[model samples]
Target: MRPPGGFPIVCHCLLLETPRGLCLVDTGFGIGEAAFGALPGYYRPLIRPVLSDAEAAHAQVTALGYDPRDVRDIVVTHLDADHAGGLRDFPWARVHLHAREHAAATRPATSADKGRYRAKQWAHGVDWMTYDDRGGETLFGLSAIRPLCGLPDLALVPLAGHSRGHSGVAVDTGSGWLLHAGDAYWFHGEVASPPHCPRTLALTQRMIATDHRERLENLARLRELPAEVRVFSAHDPRELDLAVS
Candidate 1:
């Protein structure tokens, strides 16, 4: 089938200028098709993403005249294959992620989450830097922000929901901030559309979730953020336009 402008889906990596070097939010598809483990049945009906050679994080950084090796940090939302897919491409970068998420992915309770990880995607050792819950630290009175310190302007927004350890990457863009909402919800319309979700998707998430209540609560929080904030989801390709570098 012809792609409907941005169909099937691909992840987006938010680039933030930092003091030490650049910080990458999440990696998109790897150099080739990522291998899938045993079928989830739900995954069977799906068509894989059409990775654009012209749109990868590595290529984009190179096109901007900066070397990919210069990227000093990579903050992951979670370790789902799609979210952690391109990690191997930038091996030299120090990775950051939620401690709960790191434990879940690297050491899951059951097979559901563990199955989502593909060995090829995470060739690098599991050494993601972890962030702890700060007692409601606020930025512009908004409680969803945390600092990246040595990395500068980038902040980690704890947006757990789609996965146990999932979090959002918030970048201060002078005028406002951009929030990368991982897989908190699939389509943008679902954010305020009465929280209705297909049974299959919801069930899979619940079964694999390390904390479902936290995820839904985070989604609620997203709805309440200031209008100046623009949120993006990993599966929502439309967001790429909003976050284009």
Candidate 2:
């Protein structure tokens, strides 16, 4: 399938306004260009991060008329450099991730693992809150963890495949739930019943997937979710446009 034009691959992040404080779903390319350029030669060109100083996650928070310091919690789908890059911006915020992801990131045992995680992103020290898939309502054949920690109306749905502890962050936004399926699938078509995808995107998914079979299974399940659930992945520009529009 040929991809629709004018939709560049976006490193989208979600900033939520909660009663406790401002909560962020994922931090997109939070680091400076210098730091990103300093990445290892082998992986630097592969990622080719388009980081802008003005576009840092914290700066965007300030632009949105919210104080960066007020952000108290950050719920992540995984710890990939692009997703977790902004962590250092709000050091005071407690970072949440799946326990398995925390382990994989902290102690990378394989070459692929080492390539994806950048140590500099979290070097500022984060108050890490690791969650196990223990409790929550089952939504569409998936574990929907409601009120993770003190986060009301927020749920952590474990859809581990791309990474050991990768998950989707589900938020109840009064009207309905928004499921941020981080890196679960690259293209919107992946979750479509027929599962159509651009050849390049399909290749990239295969290259980065930690478990190809599991990823496919998760995508199939996402397609089965009710329409009101409002599901979208981290990287798909079409999905991002629909959510924000």
- Whose TM-score is greatest here? 2
lDDT of 2 by residue, 1-245 (tens): 12234335777688998878999999876647455542556544555555686777899889888899999999989998778878888889999888889989989989988877888788879899988767657966788766677787788888878898899998888998889999988888888768898887787777778998888888778988998988888888888788768
Q: Give me the displacement of residue 22 in model 2, in angstroms.
A: 0.2
lDDT of 1 by residue, 32-54 (tens): 53243322334434544455555
**Relative to the unseen true structure, what is the Cα RMSD of model 1?**
4.0
User: How close to the true structure is residue 166 of candidate 2, measured as C-alpha lDDT?
Assistant: 91
Q: State residue 70's C-alpha deviation in candidate 1, in Å.
A: 1.1
lDDT of each: 0.68, 0.81
lDDT score at residue 207, model 1, on the 0-100 scale: 62
Worst 10 residues of 2 by lDDT: 1-10
Q: Against the true structure, what is every candidate's RMSD?
A: 4.0, 2.8
